[model samples]
Target: MGLGRGLAIGTLAVGLLVTSETPALAGNGPAYKDSWRPVKVRVADLLGRMSLDDKLGQMMQAERLGVKSPADVTTGRLGSLLSGGSSQPTPNTPVTWADMYDGFQKAALATPLGIPLVYGVDAVHGHNGVYGATVFPHNIGLGASRDPRLVQKIGRATAEEVSGTGIDWDFAPCLCVARNDRWGRTYESFGEVPQLATEMSTVITGLQGTRLDQPGSVMATAKHYVGDGGTTGGVNEGNTEISEQELRAVHLPPFKAAVDRGVGSVMISYSSWNGVKMHAGSYLINDVLKKELGFKGIVVSDYNGVDKIDGKTGFTPEEVEASINAGIDMVMVPYNWQTFIDTLRTLVQQGRVPLSRIDDANRRILTKKFELGLFEHPLTDRRFLKTIGSKDHRDLALQAVRESQVLLKNDHHVLPLLKHGKIFVAGKNADDMGNQSGGWTVGWQGTSGPVIPGTTILQGIRSSSSKVTYAKDGTGIDQSYDVAVAVVGETPYAETKGDRPQGMGLDDTDLATLQKLKDSGVPTVVVLVSGRPLDIAAQVGDWAGLVESWLPGSEGAGVADVLFGDYNPTGKLPVTWMRSAGQQPINVGDGRPALFPFGYGLHYSRHW
Candidate 1:
């Protein structure tokens, strides 16, 4: 019998004979149901059995909040679901996340074909969407460490935490080579050089494990496909006006590295390449990425990415047709996914979209599901639940924090503060976990105050020494203190809201806070907690020491370790520090004078 006919008979038999603990099918079932078959062979078998609705459903991904009910997953046969950065279940614990994931997976399995649903999340920076999960230092910090091995370890730890929550896919290891400090998402980039981003792609291996089906392994995504960080004026989602050579040189290497590492998915950029929307750029998506780069993985649209194809608010039939034909395998239509399903169906029936394209998309997506072992193990693996925010992961994060600190200035050997001295700490970031963690934390844009469990920088300092005093605005700090530390810089922000088109200096609050400490004349040290470099040259002359703590997540003790000489400062600048906002796009070879050059850093021994 044909695979479709066999699948029908097998489904009936599975319903009658298969128990919760048994295999999905018995001895004489369809080949797709077998766990020992090759992934491609199984995908082909499953594809042959799927109806047009099944194929269409596999191409659609909806937001968890917009899913309405489990009936939506069953009736719509939705293949995937995602939690936007802020979306989470009540209590937002790891167990709750696994419960939510299993609920969705159960609904997906209830469908006639019983195809497993693959849930995705932007677990960028350590399964960041869930509370109490280990939050590693953002990519910029990792880049500064120049340690690919460490990044790979972080990826493994992150996969364990995410797998514990029953999430099998991670949209992370952003390969964008950030060319400008003004870009809000600059911190997401490993560094300005393509080499750095390429080196950091080891995180992909860590996330995916040696094999896709390995325990604690999760699918990795190389994202914002090309040239998101090289936009003019560092505008978020703006056009990248560079030539093909420059694009390949500066922006494409990391993705090439990701593909080399066997990445499971590539997310198309929201930004354009020389006025051409990446979503609708058939030549680049189809010819270059798929054909030239040999990326056999799924090409997923960014969040609502297809809607902006025609520069319009919502997606259209033409946009859908163009995007799919342009090599997009999955469309992340978060809310109006039903409309997407219906529109694509109509387009296919009208001969606007070819059935071959649908089959191709399903083939790529199903291959991954098979490789993930979702057919046999479709529910949450409760074994990994204990790994979330575990002490071991926190220790790793602390080491990352210790290594990512870049000491930009140490005038007259002021750093490595004496352990028993009277030390005064003041600034907005000193005691704030939310501010130190930056964006993509428990919430979408991230919020201030103890949003999750982690040591504040102030707490780290107090734990290290008994003579630490803190004031939010530099109050009560006087000459009597042996040293004054001002932790200050940008607060939490992500993507569009993060771009700094104009001034990129310390705000009045931070400047005022520093001035108070500087005025006291007790050898003031400035510890900057920020995502990207701030324009601090104007006031550098007044500070005794300066340290760049690039949004060290959940481990304030690491920052304290460097401050108190427990760990020597070793992190180098990933991006060049601008002397002024006018030198916005300064890079390593650009030859423009920098306040602190790229790769510039100081050590206590060297400075002393």
Candidate 2:
């Protein structure tokens, strides 16, 4: 009989398998079912019993929306499922997510082997897919704080939130050392230097906790492995055409750090090195990452990452064979998962892809499942559900927001606005939570206007001072107001859509608003809410003060904290600030003058 038919017969014979609450067997069951056995031993025992179909199913990961029904997971024997950035259940509440996870997990346990499914999500910056979850500053903002310990705490908090929703994997702490600000995903990167990204990898520890099986601990993924940030022209998924020496020096340190930290997974990048797609580059994926770096954990492909191996829209049999052979343990097929599974199985049977590779992938994947204690605790631990968006997490986010504020230009102590003054707040980002949070907040590219619950900068300013006026476009402003604060910058954007190919300056609306504030003759403070540095040299001379509040998610009060002296501005530039868009890809020690040098920041006591 075929593997598929055999799987159906085996599942029927097994009947309704025991739930995670009960051990599948008594003292006499297989060693793999025993929690007391070492993870390696259990993985080996389980691998011996799994059919070829089971192993194939374990290699496929489909998107949650693409699953035709719960039976698809059981029949296909899927090992994992993920919610795309915009994918969410109705109402998008914490409880709803928990319910959804439990529903999917129940189907996985019904398989013949009863292996629990490991659900994954892009909890990039705090369980960002769920509504009401605490949205912390993006990686760029944390990079400015230069506090690894703080980043670790944020990671722990993020893990708790993710665990509450029953997600075992987080595709985060994007270890990319963004070489250019024009990259749309620059905000996702820690900084431009390998050292900074290396230091921030502490988040892997926080996410995985002391152990993978520990309560509230989730598996962490060091993502977009290799030279994603060094792509020429700052193009998303573009080619990185540097030498092997330069690649090792600039792009390889963070992955090494992640491997050293025992990160549960390393995601392959969509970008290529020397015109070779990372998804299919065996030299880098197997030789460099798996062998040289000694990364024992699973190597997962990015979203439909394997499909792009052939540089086409859809995946080919060759693409599948190349990616799997390149040391990718699991493929995130998303939509066309069935096709992937069928093609992979055919390739293996045809001797085009060896069974040794399949077993190797299964072993790596099962090791994590065993380590995570999935066999014993397959359901959502409701204990963490209460922790989502809890006051404690929000407080932590507030502190992160405070530390991420980089004071660029504070002329004559214009900041720490006196306790008694009428403050006029204007600009598109001033009163918008979505803008403050930036991309990856409840949605993919993230939308504007209260997409999630969070205090806006204007609200923060109002609460800080009794006298405060707000206008979106800087209307009705005069010298009568002691200060005019314009919180303006790029709105929400993610990945390719966010790439600024040409001009990277303030928009006409922002300019008009700043002009209004400038006309008032009142000292104006320009608080830029952006994912990366903007081209503001021409206008920097016009503003009395400038602050780079790089997407301070959910905690605008922290921005107010710095503006009112409750907290001092200490954040430094994580990436070089270019004087003009013409100076793209500028970096420290690159022999190019910057509008603001890397590591530049001013305190309230210091004046320029």
TM-score of each: 0.96, 0.95
Kindly report which residue stretches of model 2 are placed more than 4 angstroms away from their true locations once superposed: 1-26, 606-608
lDDT of 2 by residue, 440-516 (tens): 98889999999989888888888889999888899999878988999999999999999998889999999999998
- Candidate 2 has what TM-score? 0.95
Point out the worst 10-residue segment of candidate 1 by lDDT.
11-20
Per-residue error for 485 in candidate 2, Å, reads: 0.4
How many clashes show up in model 2? Answer: 0
lDDT of 1 by residue, 1-608 (tens): 45456545444533444344544433466768888545655676677779999999999999999889978999999999999999999999999999999999999999988999999999888989999999999999999998899999999999999999999999998999999888889999999999999999999999999988888999999998989999999998899999999999999989989999999999999999999999998988899899999999889999999999888898999999999989999999999999999999999999999999999999899989988989999999999999999999999999999999999988888889988899999999999999999999998898989998999999999998999999999998887999999999989999999999989999999989988888888898999999999988889899999999999999999999999899998999998888899988999998898888889898888432
Candidate 1 segments whose C-alpha is farther than 4 A from its true place:
1-26, 606-608
What's the count of clashing pairs in each model shown? 0, 0
- For candidate 2, which ten residues in a row score worst on lDDT? 1-10
Error of 2 at 150 (Å): 0.6
- Candidate 2's displacement at residue 336, Å, is 0.8
